[model samples]
Target: MSTFRLAARVLGLAALVALLAACATGPRITTEADPEADFSRYRSFAFYSPLAIESRGYSSASSERMKAAARAEMEARGYVFTTEKPDLWLNINAYTQQRTDVTSMPTVDYAYYYSYRARGYYVVPYWRDRTDVHRYTEGTLNVDLIDASRNRLVWEGIAVGRVGRSGDAAERGARIDGAMADIFAQYPYRAGMVPAPR
Candidate 1:
């Protein structure tokens, strides 16, 4: 074994770990808005009645967390929460789906032996390919803003992320908030403000 080879292997392993850590950090966010809509006209916001999140014929726990997160983000952007004559109506929803990811990589297998005749240690290396299959829960959240006066959707934000199966209530809530923050980060405008040219 050479010192250089061991150092190379260590560096490779560290790089691999860093790449995986970056991929697992948070959700991927995407957003879309109608080009013709004037964002500056929207001043107040309200959640839709019988919200799209009522997937179970009634409001679910997840829906409540999502609404709370949306409310915080909306108010932070200077949007007033109102029930009457609001400029924008929000329809937020989320669901999880079972997903599988498959990956393949080349690996080296090695064995060591002591040669009595030579009185030296010898190493044999074997090269092979390894495949891994992982199953996980993928959660998708959608936040839609509609022009109340026109009854048309004006903008939408979406987030997709890996969802862990085990967590306390508070932990789950935090995850939802994190996802919402990621989604809203993509939104182009604040309440009653036009987006600057990009």
Candidate 2:
């Protein structure tokens, strides 16, 4: 009922809101490449067979979307797509898992202030312990680039983030696109790097 208690509660709520906001913004992206691989030799790429992805329980449509996104990104980086004898093989995979986050809310401490007896003011300290349990889905998408000749992984990019429960196809597609963009932005090679006529 007192102003001091109300202020403390307001501060706690503000902190909670900020924490949740930070979690909703975007996915975390990571990329790695083999130092010994010759990136310049890779001028073209092709997607792995649909059967390969479908065997992992992903739908054909999902595979198409991932391939399309990767194709666009690769082309932008000066790589062409080919169905036969490509220099690199591209594979996309994704998985989701349910997670529960438990966080302890910030505690507030108060100190007592004393003054002269005739015009004295006294303060009481309070402590509040709160725990929050949040349930959500975490999703991860991986883009793997393999050297077709050697059949070895040369580069990989992964994006991980919170997934929503909505079944809307359009919204999900947009999320995938955003995540792919973040992933491919880290590709080490640049576009238009072909060798000159010898």
Best by lDDT: 1
- Tell me the deviation in Å of residue 166 in model 2: 2.3
**Global Cα RMSD, each model:** 2.7, 5.6
Candidate 1 local Cα displacement, residue 185, angstroms: 1.6
Indicate the residue-level lDDT of 171 in model 2: 85
Find the candidate with the highest TM-score and give its number: 1
Error of 2 at 87 (Å): 0.4
Model 2 scores a TM of 0.78
lDDT score for residue 161 of model 2: 92
**Alpha carbon lDDT of residue 195, candidate 1?**
80
Evaluate all candidate structures by whole-model CA lDDT and list the values in order: 0.87, 0.82
Off by over 4 Å in 1: 1-11, 14-23, 111-121
Q: Candidate 2, 197: how far from true, in Å?
A: 24
Q: Model 2, which residues run further than 4 Å from truth?
A: 1-24, 50-52, 56-58, 107-125, 191-198
Candidate 1, residue 114: how far the Cα is off, in Å: 8.5
